[model samples]
Target: MTGSDPKADLHRYLQVARAAMLWKLDGLSEYDSRRPLTPTGTNLLGLVKHLASVELGYFGETFGRPSDEPLPWFEDDAEPDADLWATAAESREQIIDLYHRAWAHSDATVEALALDAPGRVPHWPAPRNEVTLHQILVHMIAETHRHAGHADIVRELIDGAAGLRKDNDNMAPGDQERWRNHRDRLERVAQEAGRSAAVLPS
Candidate 1:
């Protein structure tokens, strides 16, 4: 199928992205999953960990899906972005399974609830609270895609693998090496311009 129904497209895109992220992590040793991809320490598996928590919030907690399991890694008191990293205690398999389980729960919620169903974001400021499931679905789709992009880069860093599924041959035709070169050139141009002053101070 070229395109899909609105909700189905949005949901399936997210699901496929999530699956791609997991697939990239496949065959990686535990040590590799925790290795930072950049100066700031963004790891492939940690992104999955973060997304699992996010799915729980947007789909599970938002619609009252009854997520009874204690999320120790999701402690609100933790320092900012702490949840974005994996702990020594967390194995690659465990985090991956948790994300798959999160997907299962989230899909169930998305299916059972209507788009217009009312939901509350406890984290949202109390003065003006509550939003529809539709809003969260949109937000989650954006969030998942954003993280999924991160996963792509991390995967490339892992083994020179690229694209959402260039390996699958379902999308447009293009050479991976040429794509990388083009993206690199664009980045250089952008960075050079970005650091320059407003007047292009030569």
Candidate 2:
């Protein structure tokens, strides 16, 4: 494919990641949206909260432009991993709104600074704390997409629905029965391999 503008490209990918993440909550009840589907308590709303914090830090504070919002999760006495999930009192709308606001703030930072503009990550280790806007952009894009992947799995577990995104699922076309047969074949192969390995020398 032909190449386009760099900043536009980065922002486009970032938006895709963001939309994928938010789409995971579609058609889910409030309870399901916040449900922790993983052993480590990786929930949909929490993922949004975590990414919002990440965007605030990497794009805002790292560039010496702090957000006007207060993140109590980052406070000194806040419990560890507070940003990773929302509390019972927190509503889905509130967290989602905050995440959207973070996007706006982050976009402003990207617009104001050149990609090569100098920045500092105070939370990072001393030796590697210094960074450029381009580096931060790359880092945030990776970070956002990683969580989007997590959301994909978690969303599947909550319901049977799974895909890359709403408009473009990017999944192999197959009916439910076909998919089940495919999975069963893979499981049988795995079991056979396991049995074979079990009898081999330690």
Residue pairs that clash (backbone atoms under 3 angstroms), model 1: none
* Model 1, span 1-202: residue lDDT tens: 5755666766887777787778778777888878898998989888988988888887877778857655677697777776688888888888888888888888888888877899888888865458887788788878877887787788778876666663583445668887778889999999888777556746
Q: Write the per-residue lDDT of candidate 2 for residues 1-202, one digit (tens) a residue.
A: 9978898788888999999999998888889998988788999999999999889999988989999989999999999999998988889999999999999999999999998999999889987899998888899899999999999999988887999999999999998898899999999999999999999998
Number of clashing residue pairs, candidate 2? 0
TM-score of 1: 0.79
Candidate 2, RMSD to the unseen true structure: 1.3
Question: Worst ten-residue run, lDDT, model 1?
Answer: 163-172
* Consecutive 10-residue window with the lowest summed lDDT within model 2: 3-12
Provide backbone clash counts, one per model.
Answer: 0, 0
